[model samples]
Target chain A: MTRITSMKPVGERAIRIGFEERISEETNRYIAALCKAIEEQVHPAVTEWVPAYASLTVYYKPETSGFDEMKSFLESCVKDVHDLEGEGGRVIGIPVLYGGEGGPDLSELASHHGMDEEEVIRLHSEGDYLVYMLGFNPGFPYLGGLSDKLHTPRRDNPRQNVPAGSVGIAGEQTGIYPLASPGGWQLIGRTPARLFDPEQPDAFLLRAGDRLRFRPVDEKEYDDLCSRVENGEQIVEVEEGEHAH
Target chain B: MSFTVEKPGLLTTVQDRGRQGYQQFGLSPAGAMDEYALQMANVLVGNERNEAVLEVTMMGPVLKAEKDMVIAFAGGNLQPAIDDEEVATWKSYHVRGGSKISFGRPVNGARLYLSVRGGIEIPEVMGSRSTYLKAGLGGFEGRELRKGDRIEVGEGAGSSEVHAGRRVASEHIPSYEKEITVRAVPGPQEDYFEKEALEQFFSEVFEVSHQSDRMGYRLQGEEPLKHKNGADILSDATAFGSVQVPGDGQPIILMADRQTTGGYTKIATVIGVDLWKVAQLPPGGKIRFKKTDVHEAQRLWQEQEDILVQVASYGRS
Candidate 1:
């Protein structure tokens, strides 16, 4: 019962919606139970929703709601998202460091998959991924499982500077670049964990149904957690969703 | 009271009427690219209609005043002036105190705003004092407005009284055309184009491309669009007048500091009351797209928010 196939109108103050077009986790658990049933009844001219990789968008406020009153307030924030369960997300962790100079394509993507650079950093620091959307910059993310024997494609000559937290991968996806622009993925590692920080009070260190893992670390614990995340220290930990109240 | 710079033009910064709900963490709601000329230049300088202003861009800054203040300028018409006289945008003045105020060529639009009377004292970050200059974050220091900077102000209607000129109603100003059309609302994809490339994207025209900025605007038509089996998608969200279309089919648009998710194939959007004619177009101008649907684009976006509440009741009397 997590259907949503169409909803359209991404303007005159946003809509999108769509689901069931691909990228599993059962369509990101019905886009995280319709973003937790529209963040539990939000909709006073909505104003923010986003999710992605199977769609959600939302955003409202056309002088306080229009478009059939926000399409029946998002069709009454949909209800049977497979009997909505959600209380899961909040893993976090992060660390990294992988190869030299921010993983210069980690020994050529571990010899293009013959596996070596420490078995491509133990299959990209093994599992627990799933981010499915943040964006092409500012806090980046768009991650999805990967590990199809460490798939790798996007680099037909790309990087014109890839720095800011690196990580990469491309084809069967895997991300992390949160802002040093110009990319084409495949890098392999580098993550001091600031992941977008407009002087943080939670300025994004990952969010679209967050849950990430990764660990590794070694350039002296990535230069001591990059000087304690450049001294506004939050040094990556997260965990918290105990029934995410 | 303040203002100093001395010609830092071709891209001044600080904006407002943006930073809304954090674009779901990928943060790119970087404010005012002409939000009805930033609420009519912050209600003709009586400030606080989302205050902060100064946009400029396409050569304009020259500042000076540093104390007497109380200005206003509004969008698209970089020909403002003072030390040499000629000043006329949506009006509201009162300068003095070693004045100067300047600006000059490009008499049309490509952003202008300005406003003043006690506002740009900069601080708000996530709650926005606008300016996301590709993530340096908030205004005045999140970058731009350089060469001897200075600025400051925000105290309370620029130390009480004296800014009385008001103008606005030239039929509430909004004509900066070099051939514009805008309207858009087409789709969350428009079935990924190619119905004659979505009828040549509403009968072609395009243009505007000096590699544009404030996050987008790279159009340039000589007929490219085609898609239907390529132009990739999966990446989503992207709004401020989206349009996208990549895979070299050329379309871009997405402004007001873009990037809140995207992977191409947008096909249409521009319709927050015609996004100030695509934020006052201008590189090579031209543009086109007409379409209109989200129930008449939210009733012309709530009739352009009741024409900004009748332009704030004509700046109060």
Candidate 2:
């Protein structure tokens, strides 16, 4: 995606800057790059900076600085960051136990797509999904790059409560529930990894721009992983790439 | 120092200034509905500004003092009585151990704030004591005060000499009535509506519909002007007092328990200075809107802040 060419006033105190490209894969890359660049430069007066799937919201203290100054400052920083290509994204592998009690809706979901449960699982795990954004709930990743064959509409009526760590698909996107919440996604499997825990220093386990690969595991393995997690074993492997600028 | 809940009233929850800096995470700043009153109550008893206070809605509970404590109460027109005689509110008072404090029906306003010296002691969740009822997180066990709940009251190192008969000026006291006037600023999504709808919004008198709570207040008024793109918009961040008109045309004022984001278009936002007035309005209160610019709104907010600072300083003295 090209650099942000212009910044427009959103309100009395904030401005919205858009890149040349509409929200796309390249736009997501720009979002991550701009967030890191702005954090390194012009840190003060900024109360909060929230980066969404396609946009970044920068909230500043209006009393301290005017809108014009913040706009110019952000514009300069984005121009500089555009010259440097952003760090390559990290890939995370998540193990899941599909079908049976672990995934009650697997049979039903397969039938809805006119395929067997094994083919559904095979298609789902074969492709790598990109983390578009973290939203809806804490640590819940909105994943993109789903295979067209496994694409399915959400349940007509959402379940009152979907257990945490349940992997599901909705329309063109797929995600894992970080916590028990009402959801309309079609569940295909359950993961043993914990996506969110308030007690941990870094409560959120996933972030935007991270890639994920789902590896299938058995019921015995799921039970064993849970036990290991309870015993303070780290189930998910996270790698910090050298390219992060 | 502590207090025991003898009869937990209609709805009682511990609240502070609010949970700020987390709206991006889909969390509302679930603070006291009447923040001005909460602050005044805390300042009256020498507690910090964000100290936890009991936000009692409509009627209040009967609280029995477990120990001798100094306390202050503000907001609403509830008759707080010790045994039989009525006691004045908005001033600090000393209560002996085992004294019983109960409340009568609210004569005016909808919420009352009770703050004790040093503030109520509770575990902070997500850096706040305010209760977000829908999420079932923060505040006393992530729920409202129930019978048999014992709440601890903070005790500062220094104790001051007792004084009596201090009260807020009669003119300054908020008058809760059947109608309230709200100052507002056009929102980012205001242009989505027709020009005539904007005109009707300011000129018309809207009644507070029955479906109202901490989450939102649905209004009964003239239908909102439709847009060319219809009511479908991407879900985005929303704040308190956001006047959002859904497909039905009725405007819903997003409140403390409102979701972090919404897809409906917002017509306007109630100015910060007038939010307290909106909070005090009863379910059936009539409301009229007056449009103002963001500059004027900011100026009014500064004026309110100045007044609050003066009041807080006077209490300290």
Candidate 3:
């Protein structure tokens, strides 16, 4: 289990819990556990908790508690949950349709890396990416562990509007746009899976620290998957893994 | 009871306090630029603080009331008139159906807030009526109010005793001039800049450039202090009133439309109490920095909150 070395208060009702080591699978597990612990320990006071790539920002109502009191309470809670790390997150598999209109800059990204489209897809699909954080858009996953061969820079001039579910690359990062919005990431593919649905109980399909596996799907499969999603089908499935604590 | 915009001015959007809790997902808190004024206007009309209000920029639109309603206006020094009658702002006024509300040339400030007895009835998106124009997420189909657009007003729950006689104190209204003073504290990333840069920031009066907007106000003056550690930091969470200095050496103060996270280094953050005054400043406005200790900043914040609480209590009476 991971141990928290220090916890610093960022604002009147927020604290930055720092770990001894850089963010890893274990650190991520501890973060989730810490969030759960904080939520349980400090009930109504904890208004919001945002998990970042390496840190968790806990926002609370200042009216309920002051900075010093909250910091001390968090310190005590951290000590209690010192060894309370949870099992690793479930690994999710997402099927993506690559190339053509589905991915306008696939060829450019492939050629930029001195690799063909097939090689790019193979390298990208082979890696088990880690969901570092969810940001840039609602339910948009910032996945790490991109293959070196597939690493590419963001477009010089991003499209004014990138459609929802569009998969794109920015430097070593890969993500799916959960909603249609202006983006600058280099588009390489798109997922028929609904990354976010406000109507659902859990709007976000994925959370930070979850393991992801991308499977290449053909154009026909892409259309079929989209239709399935429109019909209220949850395409992505998670498989339970052994506890890694 | 509502109104139709006969001629939309510079920019008009339905805005309330803002969408909170969604910032982690890259959603901006696209609320009223001058939250103080917005809240004041709402209070004058007996509406909740978060009720959707109209954020009119610079010159306001010519609006035709479709139904009889009580409306209140605040923020800046725009001359708002109803049917050629000069009406005092920051107070509730009764408008007959078909009455025309026109905004004359701007006398001072950049933005204005208009609140009705019952707030505008727009579909709440992600728990907010504030318009995020870039993402097209909330308020009037996620866009600015255009000419010929009809806005619906919810029924007022407060008394209809016609409190049109009441008006907000003029002393509370912020004055927008060529130069403005903003109080700020060193940011989390303030160490990134050189000590000399920090001194330069306080010594110089930065002019608000023309390239400023709701997202960020770009300043034109002395180049911001540069960082020797030039590696682009991973995008991290940002907040309203955060003063980020990009590579260009100019400071950009993030506002309502700022992204949840950004890569630029923030040297300082405008204290919450002064943010409303900052919002009222138009482009080309000169700004002088006043560094305050965190304790003083917090004290001022508490004082402002106390004032707001007092004002809010008055609405209940």
What's the TM-score of chain A alone for every prediction? 0.34, 0.91, 0.90
- After TM-score superposition, the amount by which residue A17's alpha carbon in candidate 3 deviates from its true location, in angstroms, is 5.0
CAPRI class assigned to model 3: acceptable
- Please identify which of the two predictions, 2 or 3, would achieve the higher lDDT against the true structure: 3
Cα lDDT, all candidates: 0.81, 0.75, 0.77
Ranking by DockQ: 3, 1, 2
User: Which consecutive 10 residues in model 3 chain A have the weakest lDDT in total?
Assistant: A7-16
Model 2, span B10-84: residue lDDT tens: 889999977766655555668898887888787777677778999998888999887777777788868787655
Query: Once all C-alphas are superposed, what RMSD does model 2 give against the true structure?
Result: 3.3
Model 1 chain B: which ten-residue window has the lowest total lDDT? B155-164
Interface CA RMSD of each prediction in angstroms: 9.1, 3.7, 3.1
Q: Write the per-residue lDDT of candidate 3 for residues B43-149, one digit (tens) a residue.
A: 88877877899998888899999887888888876889989888877788888889999898788888889888889998887788999887777888789888899
Candidate DockQ values, in order, are: 0.31, 0.29, 0.36
Best model number under DockQ: 3
Instruction: Write one digit per residue (lDDT tens) for candidate 1, span B14-62.
Output: 8888788767667888888778888888888666588887888767888
TM-score of each: 0.37, 0.87, 0.91
